[model samples]
Every structure is written in structure tokens, then in C-alpha cells.
Target chain A: MSRKYAAKGIFLLLLVNLLLCIFYVSAGAVNISPADMFHAFLGDGKAEYQNILVHVRLPRMAACVLTGSGLAVSGAVIQNVLQNPLAGPNIIGVNAGAGLAVVLCSALFPYCYAVVPFAAFAGAFGAMLFIYALARKTGASRMTLIMAGVCVNSLLNAMADAVHILWDDTLTSAYGFRLGGFSSVNGKVLLPAGILILLVTAAVFLLEKELEVLTLGETVASSVGLHTTFFQFLFLLLAAALAGASVSIAGLLGFVGLLAPHISRRIVGEECRFMLPFCALFGAFLVLLCDLLARTVWAPYEMPTGILLSFLGAPFFLHLLLGRSRRRRKKHD
Target chain B: MIRCENLSAGYGEGAVIHDISWEAAEGRLTAIVGPNGSGKSTLLKSVIGQTSVERGGVYLEGKPLKQWRHKEMAKQIAYLPQSRNDASLSVFRMVLHGRFPYLAFPRRYTQKDEETVIRELKRMGISELREKPVSELSGGEKQRAYLAMALVQGAPVLLLDEPTTYLDLSAQMELMELLRQLVAEGKTVVAVLHDLNHALQYADEMVLLENGGLKQCGTSKEILQSGVLEDVFRVRIHILQDQYGKEYYGFSSEKRMRNETGPAASGHPKRLQIRS
Candidate 1:
């Protein structure tokens, strides 16, 4: 029965994702029709329509899908590894760290696009390690880990702000990316991000069993013959890669990481085999929908995707926080 | 055949169980009993290589525990901690995790694994709750579910820490009897128990620990005769026999109570703390 629901859920999500993709492609600044979008998809559209769809909208859409899926899957993996419902790339400092690295690369080595993503990846990994170290030092409780993430996030964000202030001339180019939108996305960013997302998402799928066992907590996971330390490190590395790649493309898109996996888990239980793919599709659909609104809402003016996400995500984050505390209080009673 | 040779282990800086040499023979239920903070759980954890060894080592079969691959060790020894995180997994899925050691990378459970999980659920009397989330179960039911998970590992050696801690009287007895049945089926079971009477009644052999040290290791009868329980726990105990001649150990804080209340408290009946 649940399997049937799961199938229906997947089908519905795919349909929504397809429709959103078409809407995003067709309703943009150039207003390509559904026929033209279909023709572009088939590689036989009119030349100008094909160029607009292929070169501009398609890469932007691909960036949205890749970044959205990567962040959401990374969020799911981090939440499992840390055993904290609130843990994710943005809250846990991975995106801030990546953003800091991107800002630093842009300031120091202007126009070197390839170096930015790698730096972002390295920064994300470093931030994860930093948060882990802090959590370990403080006994790694849920509250302590989140607190550590907050500290790392603030520190990295401040550093990025400092870089912006110090190198004010580069701010114009770096500002939009920092706020996280698909405006700057082209084949250069999309291609590499797409490949990395595919690889890491597959890798996460392969680690599905380990991730599920890990949700049982470290002691039980280790006792059950999982090399808990090794797998934790590997999962963290994969999460960092995913989050870092997404941050490079989308520039600190918050909440999708936290929001999408959570919604997927609610729809399909915690089994990663089902949840992971669902999270990816759900995440893509969400970002595409949000981006479509961002584009068409006020016409010529566009809201940054990150700002829209924060507005949507903050209340949800607070709700989870309060709900967790309330549950803990009830358990005590 | 699990043996600890002067095994000294602990967390970060200090050894919790120091230089404890003990052996759990095959096909017997061995209970490690001690007062709170006596390192009973630490000793059990050390046996499974969960603790940091400061000195000496543990051996499973004949090989040093460190030499055994984690998967190989998991195939031989199954361990259950005193407490587990409230993971929201179904009973069937939770039990299936026991097959992790047997499954290779891209770890998909096989037909045999599913069968074993089902069998364990039935054996633990939780087959009806296979689809139920563990978090929704009663304390006793949760313990049974965890036990089912451990049993499905199919290991010859089972180590459980305070398996009956949060259970009611009947649930405690049921779990102990289940462990005994496992022993009867040729599995070696080592459990850390807080209830001395339960340990005495259910364990074939008992190890008594006091202040991070091994005080006794022998048959329950031998440990009873050794008079270590009173000394280690700092309480006086009396042995009572039922009509069937089954002996039960009962504890009293009478001596301390008398000291506090003075000589006038002597004629008053002493309260017996009976644990069944």
C-alpha cells in the first residue's frame, strides 16, 4: 500500500518537475512557447529560440536542478550522519564556508572561474571538519553541534563580508552570486556542477544502507559491523562536495537543503533509497518553482533565490526547533 | 571462547575497567553484576573492543580482538548497548540491520537475511509488531525488538549491557529467560545485570566487579559462597529458599539503618529488599 503511494508520489513529483522545467523555460524574459521549448528539447527549434533556450534558460535550469538536488541530498546525508533533524549545509556552515571561499577566490584571482568551485569544495570540507572538531570538543550533543555550526557559519560569513569590504571593486560581479541566484549560470558552471552532482548523488545512493544504520547512532552502528568512523568521514566528504558545488553555482541557497529532505522524509519515510531520489526531485521542483516566481513575480525586477528561501525557511526552522524542544519536554514529563 | 587477558580499557584519559582477566565459556550465560559506577558496562564493552585498551588485550576464539576485521568480529559477537537512540525505524527494518556484517558493499539484504529477520521477530514474540515503528512500542516491546535485532546477527557470542534496566518485573524475567534459551541453543551470552537475584537465578556463571576491578568470576554458586557481593555492594544479604528449593538472594540496609537509628532500632523488624 505504502509502495503504491511511493510510486504515485514519485510520478507526481516527476510530472511537477517536468511541468516546472517547461514553465521556467517558456515563461522567462524571451517568452519561448511550449512548442518552441519542445522543439528546443528535440534540437530543431528556430535558431534564435533554440539559442535562448539552449544557451541561457537550459543551463540556468540545469544549474537549478543540480544545485537544488545536491543541497537537498547533502542535507539528508548530514542529518543522518549527525542524527540531528536540523543539521544541513546552510545551518551547519557548509554553504557559508563555500561562499567565503568563492568570495576569496574572486577577490584574489579575479575571472578564474574553475578555481572558485574547487576552493568552495575545499572550504566546505574545512568548515565541516571545523564544526566536527568543535562539536567533539564540546561532547557532540545535538545542541552543542548546532551551536558549533552557528559559530562557524557566522565566522565564515563575516569573513566573506570582510572580503567584500576590502575588495569593493569586485563586489558588483560577486554580489549576485553571493546572494545565490541562477542569473550568472552558464555552460561553464552548469557542466561541472552537473557532473559532480550526478557522481555524489550516486555515491550517496550506494551508501544508503550505511546511512540508515548510522541513524541508529554510533555505538549501535559500530556494533553492527559498520566502520562508523570511516563511513562518517566518507559521508561528510560527499556532503561537503555536494554542498560546495551547489554553493558555487547558487551562492548560499539556504533552506532547500533543510526543507526538501524533511518534506521527502515525511512523504517517503527515512529509507534513503526512496528518500534520496525523492529529495532530489522535490528539491529541483521547489527551486524551479521558486525561481519561476522570482522571475515573473514583479516582472523586470528579480528577487534573489537565497532571499526567497530564507523567507520560506526561517519559520519552518523555528517550528522544528520549538517542536523538538517541546517533544523533549514531553518525554521528560 | 572469549577471553580478556589483564584487559585494561577506558575512555579518553583513565581506565574504567583495570587489568581484568576473565573468560566466558561457550554455551553458557555469564552475568556481570555490580553496584552503580562499578564498571560493569565498561568491562562488557571492552570485551567487544568498543572501549580504548590502555593495556593488555581481548581474544575471540584464539586471535587477538584487534586482529579480527570488524565484520569478522561482528559475525562472531553481537552486542547490545544499555540504551539506544530512539531511531524511528520499523521493527522488521531494525532487525534486518543485524545482517549488515554479512552483506557486502552496496549492502542489499538477501532472501536469507529477510528470513532470519522474520525468524528473529517470531522468536522474540514481536512478529505481530514487525511493521510497527520502534519508537511507538512499550519499553518491554522496544527491548524485545532490540534483542531481535541482536539475535538476527546469528553470532555465537552475545553481549548485552543491562538488558533489563527499564523493564518491569515480568518483562525482566521474560528477557532473562529468553537469554537463557539462547544459551540453551548453544550461544554464549554475557549480560551486565543490576539485579543480583536475577543474575544468580538466570546466569550459569557470574562475574562480580567492584570499583573497576574484578572481584570474582565463577559459577553463581561459587560467587555466592565467596561473600563478595556483600563486601562489594556494602549491604547485608540473606538467602531464602522456595518450596521447590530454588534459592533467592534478598538484600537489606538494616545495618546502616540501625547505625543511623541507634541501638533502639534492633527490635524493629528489618525491611528486606526482595528482587525477583
Candidate 2:
């Protein structure tokens, strides 16, 4: 895509994001007017309107943006770093890792809220490094990496299930966590994870050039004086941190990581400088859009954002798979 | 100058080239030539610290290869490997990555870096390709763009492995001429070549390898006169002169030698034949 066209698309996406933010705060179960919502934000509205907007919708909105941008940027980083378009936090067991950690932490800590993000980070980072190490050791191909992810993902999710089944009351709402709704998100949980996501995403942007060099592959990257191993590890660390922290707030959200970056790649070219920010914006937009649909589409009886995401994301994933296979078949032909 | 002393190196736990000592002088185009699997590529790779040196070490400007950090080494030596990734970056962005070692914190490309990239692109006749993705370029054009990238690195020593592999005959000639130009401009260039004729025609010095060991390292005339090329390759060479009276090397394979003999068997007119 040309720079001017890409710039236009980005501006449009940003505009949509802003409009969605306003609509998200306004069009909830009780339907606070835009005027009331703005007044609530400024500490002058009806007591009920102020309470719902301040306590519930605002934090949920923040969770949506944080989870969206975090997972999307993580997806972009994993795709580029691993040289696999199919790899995402959800696909590659990263969210499952965080999910398992969150479950375990809840089962163990019971009362502590601050420990979940760190626990999730550790879990996600471990899973990423394990998968990466396995790939390196086996000299894995594109398909093999996905296969490894599937294996790790299934095992971790099963372990989390075993934990949930063994201790019933350990989770306040196990289904909601699994399906990834922002309904349970509170300020205490969102604050630390939000700070983490913002800092890590900023760090990723700073390393955009280094990440670009890494896409040149190991030999060329090393030849050009890039510490390939170190950078690869570092990027994976950032990717894990983003995915884990997001999962801490929003339960195993499946496709934002996969869908957002791919969509951003289509709009802007894959230059990290452009792709990273675009992916973040598009990711935030997709989640906010899905969350809005989750709450308003059903009205009063809300569905989990994960269900809506899967509804939108699964078909896109299938299309990607079929398209890739068709292209491979054409090449073979 | 790159000097390897008693170097035995290879990938993990095995040495492909053993106990080899060679020197590539300043401002000379040295070609390493050998048959397939004879470790010519490995020898070139060792200079850039790509291989595990089992016994000895490579010295760049009298300092040990291990002593220089990656960025410091990159500023001194530009190495181009045999295979490259088809990156989806624009040609200008791809080449501007040559300035990676110089940039600090955020690694943003400066105006000087952009100017250097543009100059190298113009030098390579690919200024129009600056915005095009490298993956979309032709084989020869991609090679030139990569060469431009290496040039923008502004290193004194350039190492290339099979740079002419995927190029056409004309493109091969152009690349060889460019290497000569680089050498003439006082850059030390060492290339691994497969074509012995190109080695003989263009190289200031030739390092001949046979079965992962150095057979000879000398000027083209010395290597040609020494007969080691014929002995190791098991092919007869004809030092032919063109119509312009400039000399070039030609060879006949052993399979051809079995069925055909002399200059007539090679099937050319008398004007093309200068020696048997």
C-alpha cells in the first residue's frame, strides 16, 4: 500500500476508535446519554448514571482497549519473530499458559489481585520460550511450529480444566473467564496489567527497526551486526508479557491477536514502523466493536466478548487456512 | 587485511575445512574456487565468524576475530551469504539497514543514512526500485540491491559467497565487473566462485581448495601455470586468446576428453584457438 493511502486508512481507523469509545461508554444496558456519559466522566451527573459509568463501563472500556492492543501487537510480533503467519498467542498456547497461571494463582492466592498479572507473565513467557526452544531444537518448519503450539495449547488448557474441576469455587465465574468477557474487569486488576501493556507496547515500537532487521533471517541479521538470538528472545519476552497481562484481565480471548495484525498488514504494508501502531489501533477497534456487540446486540442479557470474537474470528481463520492451502496447491501445480 | 592462521572450522562438532592458513590482501579481489563440497563457502563463512573455529582463529586488521563486538565487526567487514531472505521491505529500507550498526537507541535512519542508501542505489542503477519490495524484484536486480546494501555498509572489506549463482551470463559479467570496481576503489574483496573461468579472468589472486584443504593460493597465472588446477579438477585447460588478443581460460571435462581430443574436438574455428 502507498504511504498516503495507508495514512488515510490509519486516520479513518483512529476516528472510528474514538467514535467507538464514545458509543461504548454511552450505549450500555441502561443506555446513558452521550451528554450524561461525558458529564459522568467530569464528576457531574445523576448518581446512578455516574455510578454505572464510573465503576463499570469505564473500566470495561479500558479493558477492551488494553486487551485488544496488547494481543494484537503480540500477534504481530510473534508472526514476524517466528516467521510464521499462523502463529498467535491463542494458537501458540500463550493465552492458555496465562489462563493456566491465572487459575492456579486464584486457587492458591484466593484473595490477592496484584499477583495474577505477574503469574500470568511468568506462565506466558515460559510457554513462548518452550515453544521457541522446541522449534529451534527440532529445526521446525512452518507447520511444525503450529503443531507444537496445538500440542502445548491443548495440554495447558486441559491442565487448567483439571484445576477448575478439582476446585469448583476457585473461580468466581469460570465460564466467563474461559469465554473472555470484560464484565468482571475492575480497576484494581486493570491498572497493573494496563501499565504493563502500555510500557511493553512502547518498548516494541522503539525496537521496530531491530525487529525489521530480524525478519531478514538469522544469517543476514547476524551478518548485519544484529544480535539475533538476543533480539529474538527479547521480542518473544515482550510478546509474552503483552499476551499474559491482557489475559490477566480478559480471559483467554482467542482471535484478537490473530485477526488484528493480519487486518493491519492488509491496510499498511508489513513494515514494523507502520504495522505495529496500525495493528494496535485495529486491534483496539475490533475488541471495542465486539464488546459493543456483546453488550448491545443482546441487550441487558450480555454475552461474553470471546463468543462474539470467535464468531467473527473463526471464519477469518478458516479463510486464511483455505487460502494458504489453495496457494500452496497452485504453486505445486 | 583478513588473515586466517591454521584455521580449522565448521558447524557444530565437525570441521569442514582444516588447518588452512590464507591471507586476503588489501584492495585485491581474491576468489576461492573449488569443486562442489570442497569447503569454499565454509572458508568464506569463517572470515565473518560464522563457523566454529576448532583449532585456530581469523584475524581482522591484526586483532582477533573474537575480540571485536558484532557492531564493531560489522563496521569493518561486510559479508554477503549465498542465500538471502525475500524480505517484504522496500528496496530503500532494505539497503538503509546497512546503517544499523551506527544507529543508537531507537535505531532511526538519519538523513546521511538515507543519502548513502540513495547514492548506493544510484550506483547500482536501481534508484527507480527504491520503493519496490525486494521480494518482487528479478534475480539480478535483487543481487544488485543486496550489493547496494553491502556497499552502503561502507566497510573496507567485503566478502561474498556465490554472488553470481542465480544471475544470467550478462548479469554475472556485470557483477564481476562491479566487484573489480570495488577492488579498484581500494576495498578488499574476497568471493567464493564456482566458475573457474571467472576466477581466472577476474581475480587478482586465487585460493584453490580440493577436498577441504588448500591446494594453492597465488596469482591466476601462477595457479594456472602450476597445473594443480588440472590435477585436482581432472580436466584439461586451454589458455585461449580472444580476437582482441586478451587471454581467457577454458576447460574440457574428462567425459569430453574421453571421446574428443585436441582443439578440433572442442569444435571451434582456428581463429579462436591459440594453444593446445
Candidate 3:
């Protein structure tokens, strides 16, 4: 996009974000008053308002922001590392791997929510390794990699189902997680995941220059003295850690990891300096807006945040995908 | 000197370059020419330790390639791959990646790196396209951008694969002139090229590669003779001296067509004189 237009777009989004933050805090089951929200902001609200603001609203808002940045930056990094437009933690196998891990934990034992995420992290890491190795073998096997991810997901899912069938009590008990939502955020799981994402994100930004060199291809990257093997592993790890951690807290947000960064790149430009940060912000805004709508759009009865995201994010995602195609066509004409 | 002592290249059980020994002197533009699949690119990759050379290794100033780490190699030898047509990089960032090997553990690009990149873009005359995405650039612009990246690598020995493959007439001449200028400034450039005319015009030295080994290695005056080229390339060629008193060659066009049809023709001129 034109730089002027991108600047304008970002400015407008920032304004919308401020409005959404205000509006989101006022929304929920209790239907708190905006005037009371102002009091809470001014540090002199009533007990209930303070309780809602401090406990319920702030953490969720922070989650929106954190998850947004995590998924978006994760997507951008994955795409560049894989050298494929469609490559990301969600669209490729990383999320599936994480999801598989979560399902595995949920299946194997009936007692540990925390271990599910570690399982998720391991699964995501494995998936990324598979993709990299598969690509080197076949020369740009993105579609095949995605296919491999899907197959792995299905097979794990069947394992999950079989476990569910055998242990019928377990299946019915952990059903909420399998469906995907942000209904619960335990500090034990949530805090570490949050900190992990931040650390990984910092590392990614730090490696931005090396990542840029990496996209030039392995031989070129190596000739210039980059440890291409290690760099590839670094990016793959970053994507896995972020996605696995996020999915553990919020089950399978789906495509935000792919969609967010690409949109950020289009809006801001391909400099990772611009792309990574903008993707993170816009991604957070997208998730927050969806979560807010999940609470308010139907009024008093909340939709799953995943379903709400699908309703809003999919059209935008399709528009971008088709937009990319139209662009390639126009470049010639 | 950049030395390759008994260097070998292969992947998964087959070696292409076998025990090859050579040294590229500093400040010399050495051109390597070979037929298709003569393992020129393989040799370049192996020199930088891109491909696993199972038998031998490269040395820069008497230190083994393995003794110094990857980043150290980057500081010494820069390799430019054959140009890829599909990638989106701005001219500015493309050159900036050349600074990759120099960045420390918590790597951050320094302002000095930017200055060096801009300096290269200026030298290449593509400073105007600094912000333009690489996809939109003309053939010459892309070549310059890649060359700028190699310069950013800050290596004494610059290895390029077909640096002029996609260029137009004037662009080719301009790139050759730039390379000559680089050699004058005490940088060594090793290029793999198919164009004999380019090698004859600018290279200080030339090496002919055939069937995964060096056929002849010498000065351009010695190595570029029609007889040597014919022996190396498996085709007859004739030489002509240009107005500048330097030799150049062209295939005898009719003779080339006639030679393409058979292993040997009964009535061909000097059939006995030519070694098969």
C-alpha cells in the first residue's frame, strides 16, 4: 500500500482501538454503567464496578492485546522463514501440532490442564521441524506440508476421539476446551504463556535482520555467514512457542496467525520492523473487537469468541487472499 | 590468498568436485566457465561450506574454514547465488542483509551498516530504487541490488554465479566495468559465467571447468584461446582480435550446425587434425 494510506489506516485503527477499549469495558453479563466505568477509571468507583473493572475486564483486555500481538508476529515470522505466503503457525501445522498436544493431554489423563500446554508446545515444535525437513526434501512443499499437518491433526483427533469413547467421562468433562474459546484464563497457565510470548517476540524482533537475510535462500544466507540451520530453528521455535502458548490458553483461535501478519504487511509494508509490530497491534485489536462483539452483539448471551472471529475475520481474510491474486494478475497487465 | 585444498562436493552419497586444488589470489577477477552441470555452483557452495565437502576444506589467509565460525567466513568470503526471480525485497534491505554475518549475539543492525548499504547502492547507481520493492525492478536493477548485497557482506573474495545472466546489452557492459573497478580497488571477484565474451573482456584470469573438474586454469590470454575453448567445451571455435588488440571468439556458425548432426562426418575438414 502507499505509505500515506498506511499511515492513515494505522491512525484510524488506533482511534478505533481506544474506542473499543472503552466500549468493551462497559459490556458484559452485568451491563455496567459507562458513568461507573468513568469512576473506575478515576479510581473511585463502587465495589462492584471496581471488582468488574479490575478482575474481569482488565485481564481479558490484556489477553486480547497479548494474544493479538503474539499470533500476528508469529504469522509474519513463520511466513518469512518458510518463504511462503500461506505459511503460518495456524495455517500450516504449528497450531494443529499444538492442538494435537492439547488433545493428547486432555485424552491421556483427566487431571492436568497445565501439562496440556507443554504438550501443545512440543507438538507445535515437532510440526515446524517436519515442515522444514519436508520442504528441503521436495523443494517448497508448502501445500504438502499443510496437507501433512491436516493428516496429522486428523489422526491425532481420531486418537482423541478413541480416548474420548473409552473414557466417556473425560470427553464430556473437558468439552468446553475442545470447542475453542477464551472463557477462562487461569493465572498459572496464562501468566507464563504471556511472559513466554513476550520473550519470544523480543527475540524475533532481535533476529529480524538475520530473518531478512534468510529469505534470500539457504546458500545465499550461508555465504553471507548466517548459520541458516540454526536461524531456521530459531524462527520455527518462536512460532511454535507463541502459538502453543496461546492455544493452550485459548484453544485454536484459527487463521489469525496467518491473516493478521499478511494484513499488517500490506498496511505497513514488508520491513519486519513495521510488519511485526503492526501485525501484533492489529491482531490484538481484531481479537479484542471480536471478543467484545461476542459479549455485546447478541446482548446478554455470549457467542464463543472463536465463532465470532470466524464470522468477522474470514471475509476479511478472503478479501486479502483474492486481493493478493488480483495483484499478481495486474502486475503484468 | 583464498585456498581450496583437495576440496570435494556432493550430496547424499555422490561427490561432484573431487579433490580439487586451487588458490584465488587477492585482487584478481577469476572467471570460471563450464558446460551445463559441470558443478560450478557446487564448487562455490562447497567453498563457503554450504554443501558438505566430505574430503577437504577452504582456507582464508592460512586459517581453515572450520577453525573460524560461520560469521567469520561471511566477513571473508561473500557468495552471490544465481539470481532468483521471485522475492519481494526493497533495494535498501537487500543490501543491508549483507551485514548479517557481522551482527553480534543479540543482533541489531547498526547505523554504519545502513551507511555502507547506501554507499553500495550509490556505487551501483541504484540509490534511486532504495525503497522500491525488488519485484518491480528491471533486470539490471536486480543485478545491482544483489551485487550491493555482496558488497555489504564486506568480503575480500566475492563469488558470483552468472552475475550478468539477465542483463541487457548496456547493463552487461556496465556491470563488467563495475567489476573491473572493484578489482582495481583490491577486491577479488570469482564469477561463473557461460558468456565467453564477458570472460575475455574483463577477467584477469579464467578457468575452464568440464565434467566436474578443471580442464585449464591460466590467464585470459592463455586460457581463452579457441583451441583450448574447443577442447574444454566440446565444440570448435575461432578467435578474432578486436580493435583494442585483445582476442575474442565466436563459433563458426555453419561448422557448429554440421558438427551437431553426427559423432563424425566422413568429409569434415581437419577431422584427423582435431583430437576427439
Q: For each candidate, how many residue pairs have backbone atoms clashing (under 3 Å)?
A: 0, 0, 1
Structural similarity to truth (TM-score) of each candidate: 0.95, 0.95, 0.90
True contacts kept of each: 0.67, 0.75, 0.71
Candidate 2 ranges with C-alpha deviation above 4 Å:
B262-276
Give the per-residue lDDT of model 1 (tens digit) for B1-276: 799999889996899988899989789999999989989999988888888999999999979998988888899999999988888877888889999999974468999999999998988888999887788899888888888889999999999998997788988888899898899999999999989889988899999998899988999878776666766776666777666666677767747745876533222222334344
Ten-residue stretch with the least lDDT total in model 3 chain A = A172-181
DockQ-best of 1 and 3: 1
Q: Write the per-residue lDDT of candidate 3 for residues B1-276, one digit (tens) a residue.
A: 678888777775678877788888679999988889888888877777767777878887898877878888788888778856345767787778889878875567799999999899999899999989987888777888888999988888899989987788888889889888989988999998778778877899987778878777788877754356665665545555555555555554445557776553322223212222
lDDT, candidate 1, A77-131, per-residue tens: 9899888889989998999999999889889987777777778888999999888
**Candidate topping TM-score:** 2
Ordered from best to worst DockQ, the candidate numbers read 2, 1, 3
Considering the two chains of model 2, state its CAPRI-style docking category: medium
What TM value does model 1 have? 0.95
Q: DockQ for each candidate?
A: 0.75, 0.77, 0.61
Query: B74, model 1: CA deviation in Å?
Result: 0.8
Models ranked on TM-score: 2, 1, 3
Best by DockQ: 2
* Candidate 3: segments with Cα more than 4 A from true spot: A1-18, A41-44, A107-113, A173-175, A312-333, B104-108, B242-244, B253-276
